[model samples]
Target: MSAPTYIYKLVSFSSPVPDPLPEKLPLSELDVASGFIHMSTPLQVPRTLKRFFAEDPRIYILRVKYSTVEKNIKWEDSKGEVPGEVGAEGMFAHIYNRGLGTTEIESVAIWERNRDWDEPLKKAESWLVY
Candidate 1:
C-alpha cells in the first residue's frame, strides 16, 4: 500500500494547543528524550492512545500532511518497550531534526477518555484525512 497522505500526533490536553495553532509544537517528554517526535498513521491513532496515553484525560489528535514533514520523517522499527505494538508494518514515523509545525496541520480534534472509548475512537476516525 502507498504511504498515508497524513499522520497523526497525539498531544496531551494538559498542553494547550493555541486556537490558531503555533508554528512549532512543544515536544512531549518522550519526544524530547527520544530526540524525535512520535507520530502514527490514521489507523494507528486509537491503538496508540490506548497503549501510551490511556491515563490521559483528554488528547488532541493533530492531523498533519505527510508531505510537509516527509523529508524529516524516518520509517523506523518499533522503538518502544513492547515491540510492534501500535506499529504499522512494524514501523512508525519518527520526525527528526525539527519539531512538528503548524504548516503541516490540517486540523485538530479533541478526544476525551470516555468510558466505552468507542465514541472517542469514532470521532478520531472521522477527523482523519482517510
Candidate 2:
C-alpha cells in the first residue's frame, strides 16, 4: 500500500458593502450562525482515495481572514471613533436597507504531503470550498 493523501477546504463570508466604507457592515447575529451552516461538507471522494489515501493523512493547517468596518461610539470626542450621531444614523439606515454595507472575505489552506501525492492533490483541492 502507498502513503495516505490529505485534503483541505476553506470558506469565508463578509458583509455586503462597497469599498471606501470605513468598515464593512457588521454581520447580524443570525448571519453569523448561518455562515457556519454554509460551510458544510459531504464525503464524496472515491473510497480508494478516501479510505486508503486519506486515512492517517498528514496534518494540515488552514487560515481564514475576514475584514469589515465596525461602528465605534464614545462619549469623548476622538478622531478615531465615529460620532455617536453618525453611528446611529448609519445603523438606522443599514437596518432600513437604505444601502448595503460591505465586508471582504479571504481564506487560505496549507498542508504538507509526501512528494508523490503533493502536486496532483494540491491542484485539485486548491479551489475546494464549503
TM-scores, in order shown? 0.86, 0.17
Clashing pairs in 2: 5-53, 16-101, 17-101, 17-102, 23-69, 24-68, 24-69
Name the lDDT value of residue 120 in candidate 2.
Answer: 38
Tens digits of per-residue lDDT for model 1, 46-126: 678888788888888888888888888777764733334223576788888988767888888877787745678876555
- Top-lDDT structure, candidate number: 1
Least well predicted 10-residue stretch by lDDT in candidate 2:
90-99
Error of 2 at 18 (Å): 2.3
Q: Rate the local accuracy (lDDT) of all candidates.
A: 0.77, 0.27
Q: What tens-digit string does per-residue lDDT give for candidate 2 at 32-89?
A: 5433111112122222234334533333222112112112112111222333332222
lDDT of 1: 0.77
120 Cα displacement, candidate 1 (Å)? 1.0
